[model samples]
Target: MKPSKHTKNQENSRRNFIKHAAVAAAGFMIVPRHVLGGKGYLAPSDRLQVAGIGVGGKGQSDIASFAKTGKADIAFLCDVDDRRAANSIRNFPRAKYYKDYREMLDKEHRHIDAVSVSTPDHNHAVQTMAAMQLGKHVYVQKPLTHDIYEARKLTEAAQRYKVVTQMGNQGASGDGVRQLQEWLDDGQIGKVETVYCWTDRPLWPQGISWPEPAAQIPKELDWNLWLGTARDLRYVEKLVPFNWRGWWEFGTGALGDMGCHLVEPPFRILDLQYPKDVQCSVGSVYVDEFKRGYFPESCPPSSHVVMTYAKTKKTKGDLTLHWMDGGIKPERPAELEANERFGDNGVLFIGTRGKMICDVYGSNPRLLPTSRTAQARTKKTIERVPGGAEGHYGQWVEGCLAGYGKMKMSSPFEIAGPLTETLLIANLAIRGFDIREARADGKGYSYPGRDLKMIWDSQNIRVTNFEAANQYIKREYRQGWTLGV
Candidate 1:
């Protein structure tokens, strides 16, 4: 039977009201919760309307995690690659989809309270900055931005915008870091003076020249939009959906890929900040025994970067951090059994009195001598996140509901920023190692940057010792993109 006249009228009225609301909201930014609820009236049950950019791979998983909290409604999805976003579109059938983030943000700003940025590293700062400028809280992926300048600006922007923000380093919210913090407070490993973080990453290709004979851009992807802040270039096979991590123009290699997850613990536990100095050595890419491949656009096959930080209140003297990637590992601690597993990724902290080790996210923390771990330890000081590291999504969602500064965060930009900048500083050393100058004899190139230590002027955001290295601190953005105000 057909609907009655009254029911049909009510349905028509609802559609008209929604259309009118959209038109009216087009002129204004969405007001945040704290503004609407004022003080002391917000409820724990408040749901956040979240929009996702780059809704594929990690981006798809991130939105799924948010929805898992039962407190977030995935209202919008944006991605340039249709194939990559297929999963999210299927998962959130009710959500609106867009190919351009700027269009999504502009049309749906009033309906979205937060934005999750899981795009390529190059696009992170610009995308997240746009969302924040609209008064929308943000959850950006790890390593935050592609450049040191972008990281610093985003950190300051967080304060300027007074918005709730969390980095994608879920390990920051993990139980591992908290337990390690407790052990440190209890003096389980004494005073940490050195940190070693290593990862077997790039699991994709690196240290190779850009593929020749540009491949056709896939029909499923919009190439120009995917380029984002990076200069437009011919589409190459294997660069999309992943593998971009090895290219300097896009991904940040191993450091940007895993530094936030592994280095964050040390940053917090040691109260470390911008490194005063950085140096590095990288594994050369080789085609044969006679000659080495030189691909400046690609990250090295492996690297060992060392950074020095001045003493913080938490340290008795200067501290050193050693980061190794491309499957490089530090020497095994004497305390660990020869047969024991060192894990594919791990962090080792050497304190004055003893040492401690943990896997990624500071998980499975153990003191040196293995037996020592069974001994008495520090009492827990930092309150554990409700669901541990997995709670990362909920914490950000809840914090957005609580408004700016009203909720505590494990890796807010204020914290992740410096940590990321520290990693990017190490990146400078690694990239500098590849800097080549022509030899007078014309036999080949001489790398003057090799073995030089870059002394960083953190306040100035530039390297004092190496003028050439300073150029990378704030790289030029592509013509159409700007880090939003």
Candidate 2:
């Protein structure tokens, strides 16, 4: 006899809870309730007050999207760098401006309803955590946290506080990703064993070298505040404002930057919970006058990281997901036909029955034989992935206002949290030590194998080889600027 819906739901919930518990214990820990409050909601009748931190690049784009909708008031604008924050300031003249986000939150907590964090990876957790603690909803840029530990905390905060949360992986809301899920559910790629995701990132915003020593710090910028929770380091122009993506301290290199967009479809379609093991074969690290004490290791700066996920009864046994970053990609699989080689960066799903391939936007996705038989089988089920409408930022605004909306948010902490954890670990792997090692805090992980293969205690979010990698997790916070829930 079939189980009742309630029983089935209970069983599913129990299993999912166990899975999350196992992952949390071994990976990272999050306490959202400590940060986000569950006392209120922004009703549809309410006009949402929004703040923005780090107002350049993607942040500017996010601001425009928010402006498109009438539901939100851009009330606060903050950024460590004055120049970068200028445009956004002008964009919202009615909004108050500040250089430090913490000050903005502390002073304006009573009035603000939500915040958008589009800063460097290192600053995301602190600012977002601060806002959530005051019961503010948050929309953070992709790859949510700089370290695995922050991801868990932010996830918990979002859940515990009941604040509306979204990650800026815009592609998450794309109709294409949803269709990718439908395809997987319908068994288009039978008995999936492997997934290959790649990207053309590090193209513009990537490949920057390490910083040198402290030079004359810019007057317009608050160098100390910029460092925030990171270790104290000399300021370098190349490492600031924009070029931080290539640095070890500020960015997660290529993987952390692009994995959320490139890898989301597979993770969603395959229903990825957590990988049993993660290993990386990174490229050479390079040097720049900008990269002296700032980054310790050099040579093989880029990498090809391979993450392995063991199966639950739901998955097809062990699955290997390979990720390439910083312009390095794996060679085309030998099994493909002559013309079937992949493009510069895309996804390839190899299952027992056949294969499926697509790009980040999920266009030109075609199955093998690339013709009628595949089309006949897939057409009835094939649906166009929604193009970005309402956009990610717009969607967040709607959600924040409690507008009756069903727009899918790509970077909801539920998805962004794990995605961030997986990508952040790649950085942990390359650093050869967890960022928190300098501290005796029970946070961070270690890779026992030289190849950077690690077995994580997901419940505690600790690495089995903590002795080696723990050093990279938490860094020395600048005085008066530490981040805590």
Candidate 3:
């Protein structure tokens, strides 16, 4: 049957929309509009206006969480890849879209009250500093910055700009952390002296050479723009849409990935700050029969970094923190039954009297010995965040509307900044493990710097004993990519 031209065009439009929607949903979640908002719901002007940069994967979920708060207007979405950004575009159809965040900020900064940054570790500092410079509230994902310098600067900028800042480690606002603090306050775990945090991460590749032959860049992704603060390079397969965590340029490895979530409880309860000294051992990857690959461009497959912190008001003396990543775990405590779980990702606190443990995101906190978790319940001295973990988004939303420092936050920069530095310091120790230099005789490489404990002068921001380790404290940006702090 011959159809009218209008009908044929309408059919084409429907098919095109469906095809485009499906592609966006290919690697991302395509949430229904009803899930984001219902009818008769006009987002209020008083509601905080948020523009998301790098809106995909965790970024996508982050903006959605903010929207679900009913107090945030997701007014703008930005991403380097259209395919990765498709779902967010669909969820926030009314919001404007852009490929570069700088352009969005240039044009829509006036409209945006706050910005949420969920980009890679490398871009975090530049994007965050830019937003702060614009006097916009910011909700940045955890391990605040790729370098120690950036973390310190962002922490300072938040104060100077008088803008509310929240790190995306929502556990900072969770009941788990509050509960840990309460347990500490009640003296259940008296004067914690030793701590252990572990995670099974790098579910991505690490300790490998850069791909020799570059793969064709995806049509959906702007490879150059995606490189943001990283060095110029040909598009490599599997580096995008995820797996960048294994690379030193775009990601901070497992410690940066999970440390913020697992380490915050101990940091909060024990009032821990920058470590005084750090040392680490990393698992070596063997390329063949007799050769071990020390791919300078990649992080280790596994690492065990140990950091020593000076006594704080909450501690008895010098406390030791152990961070295990890349599937390495600490020896199981005798208190836990072999049959029971110690959690795939968790933190353990050892004190004068007892021990406590918690899972990732600081959830399911408990005193060791399954029975003690219930038996030794402390009074709820610390107030709980309403709605618990999910409240993190709302807490930031309310705080943004209330002005900087008006309302308490779960992971404010003041708190998160120092916490992030803690992990980066641990990372410095990890990076130090593989440091190499040509032998004085010029025969071969001599890893003289290896196995040395880095002495950190937090005030000066340098590794006093090992000059080579200080490089990680503040990485030089690639050409044309300034941190802008």
Candidate 4:
């Protein structure tokens, strides 16, 4: 006799349950939410699995901050220098360690939900791109990339891969920037027309020739891997750990080191994008009374770069940004008392009606005249990040768990990419200042790049007038390295 439809349905359901139960009894485990949803998924109860590349110094602090969130597990640590990584190893004894990021990514990509890259400038692009390609959320140190081209590519990749990304400019998440924003929104400062960002960085060294002698490679460090995308070169004393900041090969100089911290407040407050034109003058070192020291390999001791941006929603007209480094600073605002300290590292916004100033990381924002800070009362329109600057790591971790596009990030790649590009473009003009060509008479070199206002075609990412300056927009990687775009 034919079975009733409901009875048949019940029988089918029982058969399916028995099949699944049998499979379970045979030692097959149920797939986890992460496994079923792919690498991007994280069950609410599960902690984010994080892999840290260049896990030393800032990288060490970055992972520690993430772990502080109590919602992340520092599962892996990769650093070329074991000595540099030793502290992190002790901090996260359970975290597996590797000398090469590529190897770590290869074997453990499935286990890692996110990656933090705190390596030197040159390696930033390749390491970041590799992780983003594998579906890992990334928190990269600023300036986001060593070159302008890398910044653009990583920005596009972050969107294409649909991964949450935050640049490690913790200042972007600070409450101080929000206060400045609120003040601007309330017309307390009026429309900002000019900005000055300055830093006294390069305390390591700059405007010098590369050390001639190769130093003994540290026993615990893998020198070859440390070089990464940088041109194969002999290791020199002090270049490791920190002095690399002054060199063109591995670092982005003072502007790169502190620009993100100082320039970021103005960049965010004004809604500025790429610059239409940039020109710079760099302080020079003299070999003697007659000859100037020409160390093209090193960043200048000081530079003043002027970048002009077309009008934005936050501005009444075109905006001018001045970036000063190597202890240089803009002239003190007339409103600021002579005795009032203009911070060594600070940002000054000169609006039509008034001026606002803030120290590095956009901290201690106040009106130009110290007395006005107390009188100004602006509504808090922008929500402050929990724990302010310190919350940066946790913010990214939470965003990753929430899935892409679910949460808003303070320094997401969308904002950071252009901010980074802006600083690098200033570097381009500073580098261009040293460009020299063989004289037609063959007596000496002609410095044509000097005193030139580089007209930037932002769409093409090139300096239209100076063909020589264009070479720096994107550098050729060492033979084996690729951005993997």
Candidate 5:
């Protein structure tokens, strides 16, 4: 073996070359081809270019993070609300502005490498799918789509297109969230038998007393465009700008608005699949004849939902997930008797061995059974996930720059699409409270406690209850504005 120094050097060189080649294949190139004194990894020269669609409210904040980096350019800004999106449009002078995203994609497909989609829950799927069809990567916001049909389609589209993607649940990228995942993976929380997640949303305006008959639309808002992809309805002042979180037509209630944040930790850490049984109860806050009295359209004053998820063939067993909104709390776990209840919202994981408490969106996590557990004598190394960038937008920007899709995505469509579908079903249940209880099935879940079950073929986006509630699943787009996903 020591006969020739040349032979030894040749073997070492071969190993080094393999290592560098692996790095390059994963979309990274080691600096200094010599491989002896490289400082940092660099992305390939095809720096990605992106467009910002629906740059209003959250979009404004989200778009800037990606635009700051030279890796991508904010080539387009699209929004139905002119006033809300004006600042973003002005900020990105290079981007072409359009009220309709469909037109923007058609005109700018060649120049765009990806899109940042931060529209309302209802329009997410249509806009995202359209962009994907053109072979563009997408960074869509949480609660990926309005309905189950749309969510499933988005997952398929992303897989088919093989484009880089990241979902807008920035919390998923946080160090705290990664810690939660590690804790679960290490069985810190034994078999997670139950999970309770809640939030104090509608802080923007939720739990509004049901509204009266449709009111006149405000002049500042584009009522028709605002209702894009939604059924025709006279615009009301209460629903536009920021109050849509509560309404069945446009929003997902608190669950849709916050579930992706509050429940996601458990889903990821616990590897949860669809629930086998789902049931919900809403408080008596109705003020109008049509279940429509307050000015703003939102959800009931309060609601509690219980979902039972059966363990997959590979998982341990059955698990129960509970969601509460409007300052509600499930029966506290016996161990945390003195621990303060989740004031506005938080998630609790109850495992066979021990439980973990993670703040909503996985901000701060602490172990339960503190008294019984011993502190480690030596400092333990914690594995950090790559997605935690500062805010959600910043992470997406970094991902865009991460050529060859090397970045770790927190809410990739694969993980987010199903979660969105589960939350959207809760909305469907609210609208069809009177008809029939649908059961969770292979094609899609159904509402239980009803006389007839709504058979949903999610692959086809059709429903057995077409005569009954299909109208609720898919909305009619207003004239002059049509979106295809």
Candidate 6:
């Protein structure tokens, strides 16, 4: 858990900068903010200085949202691809740009008060951990980390470093989730027994083989940096900007992409924690009429994962949660009329008394009977975020300013870590579905992972029933890359 040499140098640089800043400010007379620039004017030092990693697409909006808070200054931006970073660079013309996050942290850590990580799944742990080690508050995008081990480490680091931390699952801050929680608390849905969360994701290709003849690397991209923590591989066309979600090496498939948003409600309302066991069945692809294609390098086309969690205080008994992706959905509840539509992506909570459903991000929650939705009334006991989901960014900025443990954040590492681990644990079952071994007779193959249930030892962070599935828990980093803990 010792800091790396580079981290140590950054810490020293931060100290020196603070010392010089104080000495330089000694010559200036203290003046009221109103005298300097009229009323309600904030001095530069009053704003939170933020450095954004992977500043493109979601990253662009994430940093922009923070800046919109008027309490944070976008001071730096980092991305492996210049093309993706272009919009962010133009939007925050005053922000310094860097291709490597390590370089940004080394040279600019002294100036950054917070870091926003909107990178690929594989790089989230390292990048976020780096910022946290420098005592910079962090807001990382959803799923937290690519692996359960990484997720656990980041969770522990947040507590160890005592820095304000928030995960990018904005739904945790939405009003819909609070309403759902209030309903459950009021026993509107008495003693939940089962939950189903589904998403029509993986719009990108999956269950397919890797592209043959690697495509030419784009001039604007640094392929090595983009592949940080993942195995070194040649660039393939259509993999940048998006589509990486389909591949196991660079992305985490549909579950990782959408699970945080959809599963978060049940996780919060039910007070669920680590799953006891998981089993899954996946849709397959065929290369021809005779052979079913086996592409272990890619995620399955579709999957249905079932996980069992011991009952929490709110539940009457053990709870079963089903997660389906790639356009699959659960059976509709009979309470709905034939004309009613079940959402393409939604969550269903079945309780002893009734059922409730909601769209992604816990939005538009309604009781199953539909008629009951309007009639149902519950106390507004749970506090709501100022602007609901849109307030997620400003909440984090304010929390950082309030300092650790001073203010509450909707999806801090304490909650996001375990939620992410649960999804990744389910993925172990999905990925294990294809672990094939050559038959001893050398005639065919034996798929031991098929039809098998993985028993997880949460404390140990491994699957006790299947050894092969544990490989995905923590991946070996590529050379020159480290999680730094």
Q: Cα RMSD (Å) per model?
A: 9.5, 15.6, 14.0, 4.0, 10.5, 9.3
lDDT of 6: 0.93
lDDT of 1 by residue, 96-184 (tens): 99999999998999899999999999999999999989999999998799999999999999999999999999989988888787878
Better by TM-score, candidate 5 or 4: 4
Worst 10 residues of 1 by lDDT: 38-47
Cα lDDT listed for each candidate: 0.89, 0.71, 0.89, 0.92, 0.70, 0.93
Select the stronger candidate by TM-score from 2 and 5: 2
Q: Which one is best on lDDT?
A: 6
| Candidate 3 C-alpha lDDT tens digits along 1-485 | 89999999999999999999899887468554444567644446567899999899999999999999877899999999999899999999999999999899999998999999999899999999999999999999987999999999999999999999899998888888888888888998888889999999879999999987889998889888889888887788899977898899888999999999898888888888899998888888988898888897898999999899999877779999999988899989999997989878999999998998999888998887879888985788888888888899999999998998799998999999999998998888888777888888999798755678789999998899988888888877778888675
Task: Write the number of the candidate with greater lDDT, choosing between 2 and 6.
Answer: 6
Runs in model 3 lying further than 4 Å from the true structure: 1-43
Off by over 4 Å in 4: 1-45
- The lDDT of model 5 is 0.70
What TM-score does candidate 3 reach? Answer: 0.90
TM-score of 1: 0.90
Residue 300 of model 5, lDDT score: 64
Q: Please write out the lDDT profile of model 5 over residues 1-485, one tens digit for every residue.
A: 46588888999999999998888877554444435435443343345677787798888877787866545577788888888888997888877888878788889899888898888887787788888889888998878877776777788888888777778877777776667666666666666777888876656555554456778665556666667777776665556667777776677878888888888888777777566545566655556677533332456666677776768432357887788887787776667658655447788888777877877778877677544334413233454544454555665566655642577667788888877876766555555543443355655344343433344454455454445655566666556444454
State the TM-score for model 4.
0.93
Q: What's the number of clashes in each of the models?
A: 2, 57, 0, 0, 19, 0
Tens digits of per-residue lDDT for model 2 on 1-485? 98999999999999999999999886555444423435453343366788889887788778778876766778888877787878887888888888988788888898888899998888889889888888888999887988888898998988887788998887777666665565666776677888888876775344333445657887778988888776687786666766677666777767777788788777776777666666665443345565422234322345676777776432578888888766666666555578865777788788877777777655456665555225634443544323362466677877877732244455689888987787776666666622222324655433244555776666777667544676565565567764676
Q: After superposition, how far is residue 372 of candidate 5 from its true place, in Å?
A: 7.1
Mark the 10 consecutive residues where model 6 has the least summed lDDT. Answer: 26-35
Q: TM-scores across all candidates? A: 0.90, 0.79, 0.90, 0.93, 0.77, 0.93
lDDT of 3 at 461: 84
